[model samples]
Target: MEVVRSSIVLSRGRSRLTVTGVLTGLLLTLSVPAALPESGAVTPERGSAYMGMGVLAHDGIARGATADSLPDSRTGQTEGVDVSSYQRDVAWSTLYGSGVRWAYTKATEGTSYKNAYFTQQYTGSYDVGIVRGAYHFATPDSTGGAAQADYFVNHGGGWSADGKTLPGVLDIEWNPYGGDCYGKSKSQMVTWIRDFLNRYKARTGRAAVIYTATNWWTQCTGNYSGFGATNPLWIARYASTPGTLPAGWAYYTMWQYTSTGKTVGDHDRFNGGTTQLKTFASG
Candidate 1:
């Protein structure tokens, strides 16, 4: 720091700059951005994180495509939605009346944040006869996956045998606050994910659904396929088709096809019809 300042001061005379201008410019250039706060600072804010909140923010959304444009996209499929604290009070009855059959609400993030609207979104979905589940937005850089999983399960991410509740989802995608991969290598990422999934199933006696965009998964996990058999895939693609999916999965269990739903929160499609969705919920 001293050497750099000395060099800047030495260049002041040659560059013909005033001392005040030089010092001010140097400090301004070195200052950290206000938008990207330190993790310690930002986590305390307890911000809401919906499914694909990080994915959409970090990964570019597919252009010139809407779910309706694809003729086969909605034919006989069960509809669903995923919400978070951002959704505040969701209209679950309206969604259920409009052909929605299932829902997932954001329950936790990292080991610090829990969605304040989780009870309303989660219980309301159930009350309306929409199969409901909870999701945890993962932040691998902040804490261990198992620890985060425990935090999630403790804070409304737990599954039940009531048949109206689906297994909790692990919303692992792009990191919205910083580097996309959360600073982990492909292998490290797989390990972290494994820890979370294992802990979730062990805790709840059911495998958690894994939600992610294909590009982000490829970049972070090197398209790891080992989890496909145990964890159901919830692929996020804003376009008509799910496009090429992340490795391991033969077919997506759920597709979060549109982030912009008509006032019902982010809409999704269960790859199968209502019966299959019920069976999935029972499991």
Candidate 2:
């Protein structure tokens, strides 16, 4: 994480995120307040943010025994999907009918890397009325954190919401650059996260989400209390059951329980619950 300063303004309608600070190259988060509900529409909670919007800032480094399984519903409308360039060809209408109420599409990475489907997915998800967010995969060795943040804010497009825009996330998973980029060294990583968050907050007027895998949480990112209350978390763990994570880990709003998800509009990806979605939409 790099070092920067910022403030956030949450929307209470439309569930979109916005910002007003200098954009950087690192991945980050943004939020908004949902507007009061109208007929046939859901209203977002005033000044409330969803926990599932949190993104894992790194790859899976979780070890040891998994927790006991929690009762999970196989079919529902609130649960969402994550798609990338590979799945661009999939029809968006299939997702709308399949109960995908929300979605996050991969936008871009580095100078040359871009998710081919982001443009279509962003518009398609909005048209279908599914809450949508964007994410960028960041590497410690590749572009600097600020650079990645700039790419995301500039290319990831805009957010519109009363509670929050789909969270801007930094996917800190596998590092294409070997060495410490994937090994132990919290100082630089934490600095990178903080920097990204600060720059994004300054530019977006909202807190940014951090996405990462369970294994990476323990291996790289430890208890980062500095994130404060505004930051939400998204945890990725491919497991048989979903519940509390490790003792050091806090409660996540969204849990990616499975990667090989059999969803209507998505390929193999993490699947999780959206129990509080209505709450986030309530005024």
Candidate 3:
């Protein structure tokens, strides 16, 4: 995971754009009607791309499409970052003035892999005045749904009344690393995800958001009917133009479309719809 950060920052300009975790006592403003970049020619920089220390991945929605060409306009929404220990030491203070209103800190992984940077990232984000939430990486190997919920509540820090800590998230993605996840079937993965959400909500009294890709929803968790309304969706797609998915995707509340996201604490991290920040925190 550490290597992924390095890969994301291929250029110095990109590095400068990353948000740091340390804040400088700035109040976050809730702005509406955000601006959309003009529909210009698609360039390599405008497309979706992901880079980690050793992970050079690209899932560009279109090879060279401009922003205005995308389906949904990312205007009038809150923009933010999802971070982990990978960018631990980065200064979070920079986010305050960098157009970031919300952040999601990785709190745990599986049932036992606690993120070492949770305290720093979570508190740091809060201190900087950015509305933030805690997230967990889902895995089938652990004690499963209910068990994972226990780990998150007990170890991932309690939720906040202001909803800053958020209802939490379940990151279900393909693991290329050495594990039972080398190539887990989509159905099997969705079953485990639902189990985890069921237990997580039961324990926290809050709905858990699903952070996944368009492909994941269509291929693995196609039955949006099963996930239900209370379960908010956080869709991740690396596309130049943004748009809504199918009806089953109506539950979606956030969309992550950029990876060259440079902020104060996080350099070359993932970025998403600004509306998500407002909706998650109801700010």
Ranking by lDDT: 1, 3, 2
Using lDDT as the measure, the top candidate is 1
Against the true structure, what is each candidate's TM-score? 0.81, 0.64, 0.68
Badly placed stretches (over 4 Å) of model 2 are 1-77, 162-164, 180-184, 243-249, 261-283
Model 2, 1-283: lDDT tens digits are 1222243222222132322221111111222222233365443322121212222112221233222231135443255667665454546666666555677777766534667667887778767666677777665565567777777788883444543346577666534334424444677777887777777777666566666655555556664555636666666653444444533336665555433211222211223345355344221
Residues 1-283, candidate 1: write the lDDT tens digits. 1123323421111111221211101210111112222455343143444566555554434666433352234576887878877568997777776677899988889998878888898889888898999989898999999999999999999988877889999999876567779899999999999999999989999999999999999989999999998889999886667899888899999998756422356668898888888888889
Q: Once model 2 is optimally superposed onto the true structure by TM-score, how far is the C-alpha of residue 73 displaced, in angstroms?
A: 1.1
Model 3, stretches more than 4 Å misplaced?
Answer: 1-61, 65-74, 178-187, 222-224, 243-247, 261-279
Compared with the true structure, what per-residue lDDT tens digits does model 3 show for residues 194-215? 7788777777677787776554
Candidates arranged by TM-score, highest first: 1, 3, 2
Q: Which lDDT values do the candidates have, in the order given?
A: 0.74, 0.50, 0.53
Model 3 lDDT, full chain set = 0.53
TM-score of 3: 0.68
